[model samples]
Target: MIAEGVKAPAFSLPDASGRMISLSDCIGQKVLVIFYPGDDTPVCTAQLCDYRNNVLEFTRRGIAVLGISGDSVESHRLFAEKHELPFTLLSDSDKRVAKAFDALGFLGMSQRAYVLVDETGVVLLAYSDFLPVTYQPMKDLLARIDAAS
Candidate 1:
């Protein structure tokens, strides 16, 4: 996994709308990058929905949330629409971004992971959970954001 305090690897990927989004575009804001295995799966859906439900809190703090997975743009669109997710879901179909973040596991799927990066592109937090049902909770992410500030 990428370590805290390191510069985050830059990436440009397609969002649900098929528009390209680059990490550089968020250079002046805190970014929460979530790397999950797939879309529409039970745990992935629940985790993203939880983030969606708390999006306001993140917005209030000037933080941007992004979800990345190996799924295609079409799949991302369907999943985001179904869940009503307010944040961007980027398609990493080649798993290149996942590899950059060291999120890919032995199974060739991204292990559930998160990288909280500050405005300058420095990583503030790096966490991953191998088990599908478990994830880094929103409250913990909030606490880390507060601490980072």
Candidate 2:
């Protein structure tokens, strides 16, 4: 995992709509980068849906949530639309971003991970859950972000 207090690696990936979103674009705000194994899968779906449901909490705190996976933009579009995900669903088709964040697992699978980057792109928190079923809660994440600030 990337270490806190270190500058995050720069990245640019496609979103569900195929628009390019770069880490630089969120430079002035806190961003929660969520890395998951795949789209529409059981645990991944649940994890994203939970975030979707509480997205307002994140937005209220001026935080942006971005979900990344190896899935294609088409798959990301379908999944986000089906689940009504309010946040951006980024497509890291090559798994480059996942590898950069140390969120890549065996066989090139994306692991469940979360990286919190502050306004200046310094990592505030970096966590990876090897157990696919486990996910960090929004409340806890918010608390950590608040405390980090």
Candidate 3:
């Protein structure tokens, strides 16, 4: 995983609508970038829904949530629409972005991980779990972001 306090690598990946979104575009807001394994899977679904449920709180704090996976944009679109996820779901079909963040595992799948990036693009927290069924709790993630701020 990328270390906290290191500069986040720049990236521009396609969103569900096929529009490119770059880290630089989020320079003025705290960003929570989540790298998950795939779309429609049980653990991944639950993890994303957790974030979706708390999206209002994140927005209130000016934090932007982004979900990245190797899934295609179409899959992302369907998943986001089905779950009513308000965040941007970026398509990393080639795993380039995941590899850059060190979230890609030996199986060529992204580990369940997240990086909390400050407004200035410095990583505030970097966390990942190799176990697909395990994910960091939403409250814990929020606390870290709060402490960082």
Please provide TM-scores, in order, for all candidate models, with all chains considered together. Answer: 0.95, 0.95, 0.95
Query: So what's the TM-score on candidate 3?
Result: 0.95
Residue-level lDDT of model 1, residues 1-149, one tens digit each, is 99899999999999999999999999999998999989989889888888898899899999899999999999999999999999999999999999999999889998899888999999998878857678767898688678876
Error of 3 at 45 (Å): 0.6
Please give me the total number of clashing residue pairs in predicted model 3.
0
Q: List all candidate RMSDs to the true structure.
A: 1.1, 1.2, 1.1
lDDT of model 3 at residue 74?
99
The true-structure Cα RMSD of candidate 2 reads: 1.2
- In model 3, where do residues sit more than 4 Å from their true spots? none
Clashes of 1: 0
The better-scoring model by lDDT among 1 and 2 is 1
lDDT of 3 by residue, 1-149 (tens): 99999999999999999999999999988999999999999989988898889888799899999999999999999999999988999999999999999999889999999898999999998988758787767897788778877
lDDT of each: 0.91, 0.90, 0.91
Worst ten-residue run, lDDT, model 2? Answer: 136-145
Which of 2 and 3 is ahead in lDDT? 3
Off by more than 4 A, model 1: none
In lDDT terms, which candidate is top? Answer: 3
Which TM-score value belongs to model 2? 0.95
